[model samples]
Target: MSTALNWLSALDHPEFLADRVSAALRQWPDGDAEAVQVAEIDPAIADTSALVAATDITLESSANCLVVRARRSGTETLAAVLVLATTKADINTAIRKTLGARKCSFMSMDAAVEATGMEYGGITPIGLPQDWPLLIDERVVAQDQIVIGSGVRRSKVRMPGPLAQQLPGAQVITDLAVPIA
Candidate 1:
């Protein structure tokens, strides 16, 4: 395990990563070098504030992944967006337009978990449905390293920030999130 993976106690094999994330990593440029470091965590502390308080990791080093849904002409579209914890995704204006939908909102928790095969509060940008867009906020990729979910509340994945840009269907967008007041 890499030093970045040392914070959390349990390290899962690459095979344990979300299916899509594992496959993407295998095909990524310099795959081994871009490999993500994962560690198990208490599901109770999986949320940002709790994770930071329990693990001593700073809030700025953590990122949040959200599932957004949009509907237009009775058709539904979904997307996964990654943003730093300090900011919120500009879903109404930026994301709705980007998705080309007249109406957009966060996906219902039930729908998200069922569709992604991942637990609530643990959904990640990795392993999302291939047809769905994966949006990476510019600010998130600007960091040197970031802690993100591992598709299960029991674990987290840490990797170089820019590595997210290499995932299948990823699109780095500027101003994807608005800084919290």
Candidate 2:
């Protein structure tokens, strides 16, 4: 859990990355651009649970992205599931229905990593392939701000949840049922 470098700053040409997210922010229309921030941690060393536990931030206020792969007949596709950190996405039923596949399941870790060109813990919706499906949990919209993977494990980015919904190729959904607290 102990860490050394600032994770977020590890990105190459961070200013350029900021500019990209900034451009997307401008299109948000109702978004508060100030909500986004870059934080650092050991992305490669931790799973979502460990990453969340290592931070002082509230779990309910963060969003996690899970890269999922589903197959229909002989065709294989990739989808990203976004959910509140306090909850987990229901990939079995929800994702299957969305993909209209009689059978849907998660891809192997190796395939997910290869498809997204992102390390497992660092996958985000911002710069994913256009063909990948993006599914977001409805609860994310209820938050004022949410933390998400910054496309790299050692770093994270925070922003208005809706902004994440509006990313190109993103399709927000409430398929995941939030467990009663």
Candidate 3:
């Protein structure tokens, strides 16, 4: 939070959060919603590498969200996956096998943004379509806290890692991703 960003309680700043994300947060059980925070960032640096290099955020504390499409028997299924920045998602192996798909790949940027109602480079699992099963790597949920997209490129959201598993239909898959190797 140098000259460009100021972290604040996300629940207190609806403007900084995507409409869907804000609504989801408000629905969180108990008062856990207060545990999340947000900080504005230059959209140009919203990509993980640039954001990490520009701020105090560390790779371990950051999470990346990806939209995946798997196809089998001419049927396509879309899902959202989240992993820590230090690890690579095992989309080609674990995910593909899990999906029982003959082929699987990331959804195109345009398709992902359109389906998620989130800005590209700022997709988060929190407000994903209710039909999309969210796959979050176990490592991400084990962390003390994580910094992830707020469904908008203009800001990032921070929350306790365990909260991620509470998102609607989230599946905490062990070995869903491999360590950065």
Candidate 4:
């Protein structure tokens, strides 16, 4: 099976991802070689591995965007991160150090949306408020193309992996740990 979308129109509430696609296109109009397409998925496809498996795509080629909960002082913050499916964030050390917080932990769903202005399972690095901090795992760059959340859970965006690191406030590093089998 391939990742082509034969039913783009069948996507429910496409606006969730449409707005993000529109913004990304306008920003990288001269870049991204592949045409951006929205692949409709069942709402239950929330995990990266599940999305890849459903689309018959390889996990290494999928950019798994994750919402991490972090705490600074008494206030908690949600950090949006993009990494390869084969890895997991080093939350207690790397992420906390990056944020320069005495304490940091993954935020809940409600906290994620309230802080990022994107819905749960829909939050993406692109089009995030300019001030939002994004940490991208370098493993993502090793792939030719990466599939990432298109600001919605119902769909994902297929784009070049390298370009993902260029979004504003995006930092690329190998701070995350490789996922265990």
Per-model TM-score, in order, reads: 0.88, 0.77, 0.95, 0.80
Off by over 4 Å in 2: 1-35, 44-46
Worst 10 residues of 3 by lDDT: 1-10
lDDT of 3 by residue, 1-181 (tens): 5344588998899798889999888888756889998999989989999998898888899999999999999999999899999999998899998788999999999999999999998899887888888899999999998999999999999989998998887999999999997
Residue 77 error, candidate 2, Å: 1.9
Q: Single out the weakest 10-residue window by summed lDDT for candidate 1.
A: 1-10
lDDT of 1 by residue, 42-149 (tens): 789889888887885678989999998899999999889999999999999888888899999998999999888888888888778888898889998898988888
lDDT of 2: 0.66
Quantify all predictions' global Cα lDDT against the true fold: 0.80, 0.66, 0.90, 0.68
Model 3 Cα shift for residue 132 (angstroms)? 1.0
| 13-122: candidate 4 lDDT, tens digit per residue | 34647474456556655535234445667767756766666667677777766677667678765566788777877777887888777786777878767766666776
Best by lDDT: 3
- lDDT per residue (tens digit) for residues 1-181 in model 2: 5343243321333542333343444454443444556776654544666765676656787687777767888887778878887876777788778877767766677887787776667766666776777888888877887777666666677677767766767777775636536
- Give the top-scoring candidate (TM-score): 3
Clashing pairs in 3: none
Candidate 4 or 2, higher TM-score:
4
* Model 3 segments more than 4 A misplaced: 1-5
Q: Each prediction's Cα RMSD?
A: 3.6, 4.4, 1.6, 3.7
Model 3 earns a TM-score of 0.95
Clashing residue pairs in candidate 4, if any? 69-105, 69-106, 69-107, 71-104
Which sequence of candidate numbers ranks them by TM-score, best first?
A: 3, 1, 4, 2
Candidate 2 has its poorest 10 consecutive residues by lDDT at 4-13
